[model samples]
Structure formats: C-alpha cells, structure tokens
Target chain A: MKTHTLSSHIISYVLLFCIGLFLVTFSIYYYFTRSTIQETTKENAVALANNTVNRIELVLNTEERIPEIVAKMLESSFLDRDSLIPFLKSILKNNKNICGSSISYEPNYFPDKGMFYAPYVFRQGSKIRSTMLGNENYEYAFMDWYQIPKMTQTPYWSEPYFDEGGGNMLMTTYSVPFYTYKKRERTFSGVVTIDISLEWLTKIMSTVKIFKTGYAFLISQNGTIITHPNKDYVMNQSIFTIAKENNQPGMRDIGRQMIKGGGNFASADFKSKWHPGKLWINYKGLPSSHWSIGVIYPESEMFASLHQINIILICLIVVGLFLLSLFTVKIIRKLTSPLKHFADSARLIAAGDFNVQLPEIKTQDEMKELYNSFSYMQKELAEYIVSLKDTTAAKEKIESELRIASEIQMAMIPHIFPPFPDLPQVDVFAVLKSAKEVGGDLYDFFVIDGNKFCFAIGDVSGKGVPASLFMAVTRTLVRSISDKEISPSVIVSTLNKSLSSNNESSMFVTFFLGVLDLATGELRYSNAGHNPPVVIRGNGDVIMFEKTKYIPVGLFEDFDYGELSLQLAPGDKIFLYTDGVSEAENVENKLFGEDNLMKVIGENVKASPRDLIHNMEVGLAEHVKGHTQSDDITMMTIVYNG
Target chain B: MNVLVTSSNDYTIVTIEGRIDATSSNEFEKSVMEVIEEGNTKIILDCSGLNYISSSGLRVFLIALKKMKAIKGQLKLCNLQPVIQGIFDVSGFATIFSIFPDQKSAMER
Candidate 1:
C-alpha cells in the first residue's frame, strides 16, 4: 500500500538512461584521446631526438674531415715533420672545435732523435702553444689514439678519454695512419691525429630537455657513456654498468642494440638511472662518431596534461547528469500535477459531495478523459439520488395511509370488553390483530330485537387493502340485513348474493353468523367457507359445528348456505375464530391447529367470555413463539347464561 | 412455487408445486391466467404436489374459477392432499368445484 510519486519513478529511469549513455560516450572518448595523446608524445620525442642527433653528427663529420685532410698531406709527403707543427698550430687556431693535434712517429723512425719524439700543438685558452706530448715518463706511442691506427693501418676514432698532460679535458681523437712510398709500395708510418674536447658535447647534452625530469644522454660505440646530464656517470660508467646497478634488463638490451649502431625513435624500453618510473626514450646513432643519443621522457610528466583533461571531462559529465536529473524531475512534476487535483476532487465526490468541481484538463490526453468521466459520474449520481428520494417519499406516504385505514377498520368493530353489561344473561369478548398495516379478519356483535344477540366473524380470502375492504363490506351487509326473525343461513346467503353480483376482482370472504337465544341458552350459527366455531359445555366437553353446504361469500351468486344449532349450558362458552387462529404458524411452520384451539376452549369452559378470549390469546402467542404473523387473527367468545 | 402446464387433446393440466402463500400467489395466478388466455376451455389443476395454500393462494384459485366461469370454460381439480382436501371441505369449495382422486379419473370426465 505504500506509494511513490510518478515523478520520482520517471526521474530514476531518466537518470539511469543518461548515466548509461554518458558511460558509453565517455569510454569511447577516453580510448581515442588516450591513444592519440600517446601517439603524439611518441612522435614529439622522436623529432627532438632526431634534431639533437643530427646536430651532433654534423659537428663530428667536420672534425673527421679535418683529420683526413691532414693525413693526406702527410701521406703525399707534402709537409715534413718541421711543417707539421705549424700546420697543426694553424689548424687548431682556425677551427675552434679542435682543441689539440699531434703527429707521432715510430720510436726511432728519425734515427737522429732519441727513443721518443712526437710533436703536439694545442690551444691553451687564448694562446697557441706547442710541446712534446710523449717522453720517457709518458708513452704516447702506446696510447689508443696512436697504437690503434698504426696497427690497423686505417683511420679510426678513439673512445673519449681524459688527456691530463696535454689538453687537460675530456676529449676524443680521430687518428689516421700515414703511408710512405718505399719501393713503390705503401708502407705504414706513424699516425696523424686531432683531438676534440668532449666538454662542449657534455654541455649540449646537459642543456637538452624534454620535460620536467626528462633529459638526454650520449654513449660511445664501446658502450661507455660519454656525455650525460649526470657528469659522474659520463666518465666512470657504461650503459651496461648503469643497467646492472638499476637491475633493468631492458636497459641492457637497449645498450646492446645501441652499440651495434641500432636504435629506435619510438620505443619506451629504457629507464633513466637518475629517475624512477617508466620513461619513453627516442634513441638514434650518430653516423660519424657511432655514438647513440637518447632523449628520455618520463611518462608521468609527458602525459600530465592528458590526465588533467580527463579529470575535467569527468567532472563536467557528473555535473551534466546532476542537472539533467533536477530538470527532469521538475518537468515531470509539472506534467503530472493534474493527477493530484483529480485525487482531491475524487475524494470530495466520494464523501457524498457529488457536485464537487473537478480540475479542468485542456490537453487531449488520458487526464482529460478522466476528467470527463468524473464529470459524467457526478451527474449520474446526483440524478440517481434525487430519484431515490422521490421513491422513498411515495412509499412512506402509502404506508401511512394503510396505517390510517387499519385504524378506521379497527374502529368499525365493537372493541368494548363487555358488550352486554346490563344483560347478565350473556357475556361476549373479541379481539382482532392484523399481520400488516390492515387486516382481512373481522368480528362483530349486536343485540337484535332487545332479546336476541347476533354475532358475526369472517375472513377475507386474501390480505392487505383488497381483503380488508371485502371484510368490511361483508360485516356491513351482515349488520344491515340481520334481524330478530332472520335465520343465520338466510342472512349469509343474501350477503353472498349481493357480494358476488359485480365482483370483477374475484375476491371472496369466509363468513360465520350466529344468533343466540339469551333466555333459552340456544345458539344458532351459519358457516360459509369458514372454520367451524368451537362450543364448550358446562361439563368441559368441546364440540364444533358440523360442515355446512355453503361456499365463502363473494364466490358465487345464488349459492345456498346452511346453518347448525347448538344448546349451551349456563357456564358453556362458544368460541369462534377465523382460520388465522387455527392456522397460525410457528417458527417451525407448524400451525396452531384446531385441536389446540378446542383444548384451550375446553380448559376455560367455566371462564367468562373475556377470560376465555384472553386464555386463547395467551395460548396462541405461546404457540407462535415470536414468529412473524403471516395472517390476520380474530377471536370471539360468547358465554350464554340460562 | 413452480407451475408446470401440459396440453392434451382433452384438457390442459396445470401442476402446481410447493407452498403458495401471499408472496407466491401472484405467480400462481399468472400461470393459470396464461393458460386461460390461451383459449383453453378445460383446465385440470393438479393438486398432487400442492402441500400448503394460504388465504391469498385461495383467492388466486377463486379468481381462476371466476375467470373460467366467465369464459364458459371448465376448471377441474384432482389429486388433492388430505390437508388441502380438508381446507376445501371447510371452505365449501369441495361442493362448488369438481374434484377427482387422480389424473386418470379426471381425464375420464
């Protein structure tokens, strides 16, 4: 029985639908945006790495070309060892990128000089200085820059090293072995070399940046880190050693790939030793120096903006959903407000105010149809109530008239307890009770010729107004025509003849008339279609009048009736009643039959007429036992005294 | 009250059953009147199933008799229960109406 508003139901469904749609749209947007941002990040990192590597390659190529030009001069014998010093000085002075140059010969190749003789010229800040780079204490012939080119008899670039005695800085040398024509064939001479300071490369790598905590680094072909943001790692560690320290097998793989002159521009397969978390790296190898340059992009910093955009998008969707719910509730409530008014009006109508005004609905919808139905029902109820009121009033009027008619009919009979108060020779009492507002039973008595007493009792065949009227007419006919000389049978026969003449309704009445001889205690009675009256003797013996050759009154004209006579003793009582007494029903539908009536009359044989009728009334009441009276009852008793 | 009517070449038989008091007299009257209105000259009211009759029911029988007499038709009754026969005897209806003990005896009339 608990109820919720339609508005709440609609709002819940709407919010659910909106949430589903938002989740689908947001998920799709998130997927494409995340992939697009990742792609752009990769492309941006690669471009930055490519730019940095190209610049480093361009500078290294120039340095390599300068050394090749000097080696060719030495090979053609165009410049002797005397011109080589000035030549190196001029080359160092012209190219600011070159920090130092040295030309080393075999230990005793000149034969005139002692064991070690190598000419070196370098720029010491703003001065052009020349000195011997190798002596008894320092062996330049055994160095990588000198020995590798001489043994390989080809040009080579050495791994970067710190030159403590000569340049006093981190530097890499490109050495080219010279050739001498001996017996018209090429013979290996000492090496011609130039050194470039790695300080500038280190400075450039330190300046390279991708984002916060993102950096660039360079590793030489031997897998030794040359220039890096962390200066300590540059000279002291290789890529493999850093990978080992960090326990990153992926870094080792990248290192192996890089030293083989292989790299990728979009692989995020490395982590910086100096930083924690995943990093995207774009690494490229320099063609001239065979050094790998890597640009590190810490993933968190690289996608920080993308994460911020996603947070903002989610917040906007949440706000949008909330606003949608609020507006939907408001709109739904506005649409359904008429139902509330209808409910109020319906309650008033149910409480008997059929004329209560209903809210008007203009829209052609279900609510409008309901309004029409309510109006129609109200009109119908009002009309029905009005007609019911009229019907009830008419019925009440008819009932009141019947009650008055019953009173009039009761007045027509002699209700005075002692009919012959002055004549101690006779006693008579009677009673009549109707089952409805009017009764069909009648009892009457009068003194005829001042010595003869005439008594009559009759029952109309039906009940209600028609039967009551018939009984009244029969009683009137008996009273008007009976006289001292008329016999009981003749009086009844004449009444029947008069009643049946024009009786179109076919109603009839049962009649009994008696003339009592007060002086002789003789009773003469006629029965016409009526229950025979009982006569109780002074000896308490009960007897009934025998059957007569007559039908009830108003049945047929010219029907002859017969009479019976009985002599009563001084204390004898003659009890007369309609069938209402003998046929009175009990709750069990058993009638108070003639036997019980005759028994009661015999028991009260010595009682007065009034006492006899009272005893019979009490016995009948006891027999009925509160059962509804189904017929009118009349009883009359005549006690003759002689 | 239930009234069943059957027509034969000689007469129409009206079988009335159950108690016919003030309430059921109208239905009894209606059934007999319908039979009389159908121009049936002879009607045999079978009282075999009639166990009780009130004054109002007696009035309906009287009306049916009067209606039949006015039309010059015959209305006979048969198979009256003893109690009902006593009522008829007291009311002197046994003298005015032709009564028979069974349907076969009434059909011979």
Candidate 2:
C-alpha cells in the first residue's frame, strides 16, 4: 500500500553493495600499485646515478693515469723534457675525452729546466698547443695542482676551477709527483698533472635522464656542484650555498651526507623559487674523485605513473558502478513486473469487478504460485456473487407472487363499510387485517329479500392462499344458499354439507351467520365453532351471546346446527369478530381476550358502528403495542336504529 | 419445520414438527409427495409436534390426499393438537378425511 517501489529498493541496495565493494577493492589495488611504481622509480633513479658516476670516474681515472705513466717513463730514463713536450702534445691530440694535459714541475725540478719552469700542452680547438707555465703572475709551483701533490707526495685531484693559465676552461687537474734516485733514497720531484675539462662531464650529466623531468648533477668533495643541468650554478654554487639560497635545510643535510661518501635515496620538500614542491633525490658517491652524483626529480614527475593509474582506477570504478546500477535496475524491473500486474488485478477486484483477466506466468516459482492463487480467488468470488444474485432473485419472485395473491384475497372481501345505505334501520362497519400477505378471515353481508338481511363472518382452519380460497368458496356457497333458504341455521347447515362433501385437505372454518328482519326487529344468528358476538345496549351494558355446542362448518355432513334469536331495541349494537381479536397478543404475550373486547365495545356503546369499530381498533392497537400480529383480524359491527 | 417419516406394514407415518407456514409448506409437500410417489399410499400425518399450520400447509395435505385417493388408498391424520383440531373443525374438514386421536386409532382406520 505504501508508495515506494520494490524495484527501486532492490536496485539501490544492490548498487550500493556493488559500489562499496568496487571502491574498497579499487582503493587497495591503487595503494599497492602506487607504492610499487614509486619503489621502482626510485631504484631506476639510483641505477641512473650509479651509471653516471661510473662513466665520469672512468674518464677521470684515464686522464689521471696518463700523467703517472709519463712520470714513470721519465724516471726510467725513457725520455727527456724535450721528448715529453712532443709526447704530451701527442697524448692530448690522441685522447678526445681529455681537454688537455699539462705537466707542471715543482719549481723546475728538472735540471734542464730552470726553477718555476712547467711544460703544458692543451687542445686549442682541434689543435694541440704546447706551452710553458710558471710566469710572474701565474706561478705553477704555487698552484693547488702542483703544491698539493708535492706536499702529499702522492697523486691527487684538484677541485674544479677555471684554468686561466693554460687550459682556459673549467677543468680539474690530476697531479702525480715524480721522483728520481739522487742518493739511493726517493725524493719528491716536480708534479706531473693533467687538466681535464669538465665540459664533457657536464654533457654526460645532462644526457643521463631519470624519467621525464629527472636529471643528474655531480658535486665535488667540498660540496661544490661540478656539473649540473642548470649550467649557471655548475662552477659557482656549492650544495650548501644552493640549499641556503632555496631556504631548504633538508637539501643541505642531503648534500652533507652525499659528500661523506654515503649514498641515499630520499625525498624532501625543497622549496626552490623555481621549483616549489617536493623532490626525490638519489645520490651516490664517486669512488675516484670523492664526488657525489645526484639524480633529482620532482615528486610529481617521479610518481606520474601512479597519478595516471589513479585516474584510470577512478574512471574504471565509476564506469563499473554505473553499469552495475543499470543492470540491477533492469533485473529488478523484470522481477517485480509480475507484482505490479498483481496489484493492478487486485485493484480491479476490490472495485467489485470479478471478471478481470489476470496475467499468466509460466515460471515455476513464487510468482507463478501467486498468479494461480489470484486466479482461483477470482473464480471463487465470481461464483459466490452469482449464487447470491440467484438467491435474491428467487426471494424477490416469491414476494411478488405473495403480493399478487394478497391483492386477490383482499378483493374477495366486502370492502365497502356500509352495506345498506338506504336502509336506515341498520348502520354496519367492518375491517379486516391479515397478519400475512393473504389471510383466511372473511366477512360478507347481503340482503336476501326486501325484509331480511343476512351477514356472516368466518375464519378458515388455516391461513394464506389455501385458506383464502376456502373462504371464497364458503362465502359463495353461503350467498348462493342464503338466496334459497331464509332460516339462518338451515343456511349454515346447508353450506357446511356442501363444503364438507369434497374437502380432502382436512380444512375447516369457524363461522357465524346472522339474519335480521327489519319489520319485527328480530335478529337470528347461528354459531358454528366461532367466537360469540357481543351485544352492547344503548345504556352501555355489554352482553356476550351464549356459545353454541356445534362444531365449525365444512367438517361434518348432516350435522345439527343451533340458532339463537335476539330482539334488538333501537340504538343497540352487535359486534362480530374472529378469534384473531380475542387472541391477539401484546409485547408480554397477553391476549386481547373476550373480556377486553367487551370492555372496549361497552365503552363505545352509544357511538356509531363505524366509530365503535374504530375505537375497538384503537384499543386493540394499544393493547398489542407494536408487536407482530399473529393472525388475521376480521371484525364487523351493526347498529340498529329502528 | 422438520419432517420425520417412519413406515410399518402398509402405512408411512410422517411426523411433522414446527409451524408449516407459506415458507415451510414446500418442504412439507416434498416429504409427503415423496412417500406418495413411492407407492406408500396409506399414510399417517402425525401432528403431535406440529404447533401450527397455514393454508399452504393445508394445500400440501390436500395434494397428498388427492394422490392417495387416486391410488384407492387411505390417508389419515392423528395426534392433532387442540389448536390444529380446532382449525379442522372450523373449516368443516373433520368429516371428509378420517382423523383419530392417536396413531393407533389412525392406523386401525
């Protein structure tokens, strides 16, 4: 009865469950996939950093060993300084990765060369140029490349610097100390050095790519940026200076760790003015130069695959849930379609249309069972309704027939109250009330001759149609016989013989017949098992006639009947009634007996016959209240006015 | 109304109970007619339990009487209450049909 639909409810719940499952599954899958991609990207960055470091180390190692080899050759008396210039020129010309090579002596340790004398050969744009160092303004003996190897008596690599004296480029010098035996003890000789331009290293760092936006950079032992993609900061900016300029102390910490020969992969929110977000940095320390190679990438670029995957996952879940909801709605619609039809059919049935055609369902499930039940109920209801209609129609037919029979019965009685209007000697009134549709009580009065009046009242043995028929027969017989026979007793006796002759129904009637002679004022009456009539005197005295011993008429043949004769004075009235009056019952089941009937008539003794009958009717009505009349009531009154 | 039938020898005793008015007279007719149709022409209507009878009830009896007469058999009425006997007397039906005060008298008749 509620307005909510079942399909919507089912679809909503199912879609909710599916979407919830999808969201949880997608979230977990996205989480693990993102973590794996990040780990793989970090490893890739580390490998790229390792490769760049190894390549730079290999170039630096080759250039540093060239000077050491030359110094060993001179110590073994392989060549002199005159031969070293041409050899250095040949070495510089032969090796393309090396920008230049210089052998700077420590204050002219060569005997052939004076103090502060140095020989250097460098590449001059596809040509090898030989030059001597140790000028007044640029003393090779005081330079870091010469001083460091002489003091440490070992091979050393100088920090990257601008070479203004010979190489004229950003270069790092690798120096090695040469020695010759003087007094059977090794002594420090001039430093053999090679100037390696950092241009090629910068090119290598730029070419080593980590993902899309990741690039590599080289930092020297003192945290100086040797080679960087941003060339402006390559020679001028140290890692500490860059970190301070960018307001990133975390970056400075990473720089310190890298320079200490520690390799690490870490992420930091290094807010540079140019790049403000987080960065992932993978740094490795170079073994040869104590430099660190760092592959730095922005966090967004490093996790770009993860971002793409998240977008794809969200799209997949949304599309999946949408399709799931569509299918769920469709399926639920199909399932509940029968229910909707059932509701429609039930509505029609409630509206009293039992002839509705229900939809058929063939599925072997609950819906089929439900449809069958509905059809069965509809058929049963229709049958019940039809049976009820038949019963009502039958009852109505009987009632109508009863009504017609009653009408015919009532027509049989003398309905006109005043029988003899011209005969002022008598005033008569009569009323008949049938308890059922047709009654057996009947009364008739006729003038036999000019001088005699014959009147009779009788009740048949039973009531309804058969009794009414008998009453008709008796009235006809009485009238027919009264015309030929004038004596009241003879008339009744003759009528009884006729009625009793062929009566096979065992039916009878209580009857009384009276004849009045106007000339003599004599009233003669015969009683046949009927109630005694009452004579009310003009002085309000009520007297009941003696009841006769004879049985009712129509019950016996040749039965002796008795007649009583009464002389009526002027203003005397005789009241005749059937047992229906004397036996009428009230609410308490008390009857309107003869005593009550006499009292009612005695009170209205002086009234006209019509008024007297009316008063008696009122009295009987009051006595009975509103209870059902058990029998037909028939009464007649005659007031003599002679 | 209820009709109970009992048979002995050549007579069927139909004991009718309650009032047989226009409404219940059809049932009374059916019961009595069924006995007549079964060739049980000699029948006794026991009215001991019958409180009243209307004209319709009388009609059923008449129909039964006619059927019995046609078959040259007798239909008797017995155990009539005073009120019912009074109806029979007033209608002058006491002479045409044989009636007895009890079942034994009716059976002998």
Candidate 3:
C-alpha cells in the first residue's frame, strides 16, 4: 500500500545491483591480492636471506683462508718465536676481517720458555697491539682453539666465545696445527689461530629488514643466537631458549633445521621473542662459518600494505556507489518528467476541462503512446460534452412544455371553490392530483339550474397524454349533455356514446355523475365502471352506492347506464373518487384500500365538505408515507343541506 | 407479470400470473396480441394466479376484448382470484366477458 516515486524505485534497484556486484568483486580481488602479496613477500624474504648468507660467507671465507695460509707458511719455514710476533701483528694489521692472531708452542718446547707460551696480536681501535698471552692466569694450551687442532691434527673452527685470556673479546677462532718435519713427518707443535670478532656479523645483520618490523638474525652452529635486532637476545639467548620462552615449540623445529645447515623458508609459522605476532623465517647456512642467517617476517607487518590497499579500494567503491545512486535518480527523473505533466493534464480534464491541452511527446515510446491516448480522450470528451449539453437543453424544453400543458389541463376542470355561491344549499369540494406532468383524472361541478346542481369525477384508464386527451373529451361530452331535464343515466349514456365514436385507442374512463335537488335533498347518480361512492347521513349512518350497471365509458357503442337514487337527510355527504384513492401505495406496496377510505370519511363525517376532503387528502398522504403517487388521485365530496 | 399461452384442441389458453400494473401491462398486452395475431379465435384467459390489476392493466384487457369482438372471436376468462374478480365486477368487465369457474368449464364453454 505504500507508494514510492519512479525515480526512487529505479535508483534503489540500481544501487542494489551495483552494491551486489561490488561486494563480489571486492571479495575475489581481496582474496587473490592477499595471497599474491604473501607469495611475493615469502619469495623476497628467501632471496634476501640467500644474499645475506652469501655476504656473511664472503667475510668468513677470507678469515678462514688467511689463517690456513698463515699456518701453512709457518709449517714450511721455521720461524723463531721472536719472529712470530711480527708475523702475527702483520697478519692482524693487513687483513681487516681478522680481529686477532696468535701462535702457541708446546709447553717447554723451548727449554728456556716457561710452561705456557703464546704470542698474541690483536687490533685495539685503529692500532695493533702485541702481547704474550700465556701466563699463570691465561693458559693457551688448555683452550679449545689450541687443543682441538692439536688433538685432530686438522683445521678447526671454534664456537664463538669470549677470549678473556687472549683477545678479551667475543670471537671465533679457526685453528690449524703445524709440524716440524723431524724424520720427514708432519707433527703437532702448537695451534696457529685467527680470531674473528662477532661484531662484524652484527653489523651485517643490522642492515636487513623485511617490511616494517621484519628483521634478520644470525644463529651460531650450536643454536646460540649470535646477532639479532633485539639486543638482549643477541648474546644472551639461544634460538631454542627463545623459542621455549615464547612457548613456540614450532620455532625449535626451525632452529634445529637452521643449526643442521638445512636452509629454506619455513613452512610452519612460528613466533620469535622479538615480536608479538606470528612470524615467517627464511634461513640459510654460511658454509664457511656453519652459522645460519635467518630473516623473520612478522605476518601482520608483511600484509600491512595489502590491508591498506583493501581499505582504500573499499572507500573508492563506496564513493562510486554514492555517485552512481545520485546520477541514477537524476536520469530516471529526467526520463519520467513527462509523466508529471500528463498527470496534471489528466487532473484538469477530470475537473470538467474537456478541452485541456496535452503536452506533445517526441519519443516514440510508452510516453508518446500515453500522450496520444490522452489527446484522444480529451477530444472525445469534448465532443461528448457538446452533445450532452444539446440533449439536456432539448429535454428541458420538453419538460417546460409539459408543465404548461399540465397547467392548461388543470384549468379545463372546475378548480374554483364553492361553485354554487348563490345556492348555499349545497357544499362541494374536490381535488385532483396527477402522477405525471399531465394526468387523466378530472373533477367538475356546476349549477345546472336554479334548484339543481351537477357534479362529476372520472379517471381515463391508462395515463399520460393520450389518457389526458381522452379525459378532456369525456369532460366536454359530460358538460354538453348534462341538463336539468335529463336523468343521470341518460346523461352518462350520451357521454359514453360520444366517447366510443372514434375510440380507436380502446381507452376508457371510470366516470361517476350525480345530480342533487337542493330543495328536496334528493340525489341521483350513475357510475360507469367506477368504484362505488359512499354516502354519510346526518344520523351517522353510512351507505355505499355499489351499483355499476355499465362498463367503463368509450369501450362500447351506445351502452346504456343505470342510475341509483338516494334520499339524503340534511347534512348528508356523498363522496366519490377514482381508484387512485383506494390503490395509493406505501413503501411496502400495501394500498390504502377502500376500507381505510371509508374509515377516514366516517371519522371526519362531522367536518364540512372542504374540511372533509382536506382530511381525506391528509389520510391518503399518511397512508402512502412518501411513496411515489403511482396514479392520478381524484376525490369529490358534495354535502346537501335541506 | 408472466403470461403463458398454450394451445389445447381448438382454443388458446393464457395463464396470467403475478401483478399486472401500469408498468407490466405492456408485456401482458404483447403476449395476448401475439396469441390473437396467431389466428387463435378462442382464448381462455386464466386468472387464477393474478393477484392485482391496475387500470392500465384493465385497458389492455379492453383492447384485447375489442379486438376479439371485431374479429368475432370468443374470449373467455376463468379462475379469477377474488380481488381480480372484484375489480372486474366493479369495472363492469364481468358483465361483458364470459366468466367460468375453472379451466375445464371454460374449455367446455
């Protein structure tokens, strides 16, 4: 029941469709773009790990070659302990990667030397410093850097440790054993070592960053974290210890893989102590150092750019939808603009403006079709109005003419009250009410002579103009034939004869004629196919003249009528009426029958003729109760006073 | 008003029913005239179901009666309801038209 404008309807549907399409497109775009960013970031992180590992290997390779080459040169040529200091200092000064170089002899290999003997050279700031390393507190022969090569008789890379006795810094040493060729065989004398300070690895690892919070870390071969962005984690925590502290058992697998020199981007996600969110790590092992370089990509930071892109895309889509809705409404309104004009024109036409103009349409679509229909309706309505006006005028003319004819017909009868003014012996009253503009009911009364009065009431059967004309002719015959000498029957017989002469219409009138003698109070009357009349005596006695000896007039030729006579006492009244009086109906179709008519007359018997007839009219109106008068009603009353 | 006409051996019987007022009198006239125009000389009008008749209805009867007279045909009426019989007697139609008590009697006549 609720209604909306056409523009709103169209705009709402368009917006709905557009929103649906955008949602699907956005969902698919977001899904693919997120995965692509993840794949690309993973690839980039792995590649960066490879380049960083290679860079660390380049430093470790030089340190390893320099120490091995120096150890080989010391074996080929016998070098005195005094010459070894220059050799160590020259090596430390020339090779910037080597932080420290040391040579240790077997305890008491020189009979004059003390129990522990090693010469060490290390870089202090920009200067090289030389020192005797073995002392009562510093035992170089018992150190892993010296003991490992002495027992294996091969080169060895040591775990990074703080050399408090020698270099007094955190460093890893690659040591190779040397031989004296006594009996032309190589033998273990002592260890020649190159110490690499871990500070260079930290410098290289610090330059790596994945996205915003992603970072690179280096872990030693024993799973010890060597260099990391988190300073507390660098030298104090191993990879496994950090993993256990963070409750990430998956990180232990990655650490195990890293320590074993199994390098790859990790499949399973893990968390590092350095970050709160989940992290992805790509680790590669350095072949020269047996240490793994790992790049940790925090998952949230890696996809942060993707999230920004999605938000920006969503904003653009929302703005686009808003503008689309606005333009959709405007265009729809423009297309339906002519409908408003047509609606206005329709309203004017409905309000009786049949000639209201309709706007023209250029488009050959439904709008144009509507305009054509409106134009057609307007033209047709205008013509119909013109014809209807003429029809109404013609009908009015006929109605006015009927009104005049009705007046003329009423004038033909004896309408004046108290017809015998001079007689005074007789009182008469009559009323004729027609159902149409003209009627067939007639009543007439006149003084036939000085002592005699003639009165008649008749109803021409059938109604309207034809019956009214018949009634007029019948009245004319009654007036022309009635005389003081003629009896009531003879007068009625003559009237009937004249009416039946050219009665091709087969119409008839129920007529009643009466002549009263003013001196004797004698009345003679004849009825021709009419309801009987009622007579009321002065003594309150009622009588009905029910004799109808002849048929209705104008039905047959030369029909003889019979007369009845009644002697009326003084103040006797005779009431005559047509069937309209008895047959008058009410809303229920019940008639005011003859009994009710007589009852009304008897009740008002004491009233005079005029008052009595008025009472009868009142009784009839009360009985009908506003029902249409179906026929002409005629009533006549004569009171004879002797 | 309903007018039903049927043919017996030599006479046409017309059964008139319901009210025959001024409005319905034209239909009554047409039904009777149609029977008469069919050259049925004898018409037995059955008034058993006739409840009321206005003067206009009486005019149609008069026209029918005059037409019968001109054609020298017999128009008999039977089974008139009391009210209709009273109207007929008062209008003096009872004197001119042949009246019978029943359809069988009218047919015999």
Model 3 regions lying over 4 Å from their true place: A1-5, A20-28, A35-43, A46-96, A101-121, A124-132, A140-194, A198-200, A212-214, A217-330, A414-424, A483-486, A538-544, A586-588, A598-627
Native contacts present in each candidate (fraction):
0.80, 0.17, 0.67
What does the TM-score come to for chain B in model 1? 0.96
lDDT of each: 0.84, 0.81, 0.84
lDDT of 1 at B94: 86
Position A517, candidate 2: lDDT? 88
Error of 1 at A282 (Å): 5.1
Q: Residue-wise lDDT of candidate 3 within A108-226, one digit each (tens)? A: 76678768678888887788998877877777788887887889787888887776754556688889887666578776777788888877777888989888877888888888888
Candidate 2 structure quality by residue, lDDT tens digits, A1-642:
756777778767887887788789878987887788788987788788888888888888877778889889767768766777898888877777666776665575766666666777887767788778777888777777778778888888889898775456788878888887668866666778777888788788889987776778889999998888787897799999999987789888999998998998888647656455788888899887888888888888877878897888789878977887788778878877888788889999989999877877878888988988999999998898889899989988988998998887777777876777798888788999988788889998877778787889998866777788888899889888987899989998998899889887767778999999877879999988787888888778889887566677775567888788999888888899998898788988677877788888768877888888899899999999998897899989988787
Models ranked on TM-score: 3, 1, 2
**What's the distance in Å from true for residue A307, model 1?**
3.8
Q: List the residue pairs that clash in candidate 2.
A: A508-B90, A508-B91, A508-B92, A509-B90, A509-B91, A554-B92, A555-B92, A555-B93
lDDT tens per residue, model 1, A113-166: 777768888878789799876787888888888888888787888998888865
Whichever of 2 and 3 has more DockQ, that candidate is: 3
Candidate 3 lDDT score relative to the true structure: 0.84
Candidate 1 residues lying further than 4 Å off, grouped into runs, are A1-5, A65-82, A86-95, A102-121, A141-194, A198-215, A218-303, A322-326, A348-367, A395-501, A508-554, A557-642, B1-6, B13-31, B45-58, B77-105
Model 2 Cα shift for residue A522 (angstroms): 28
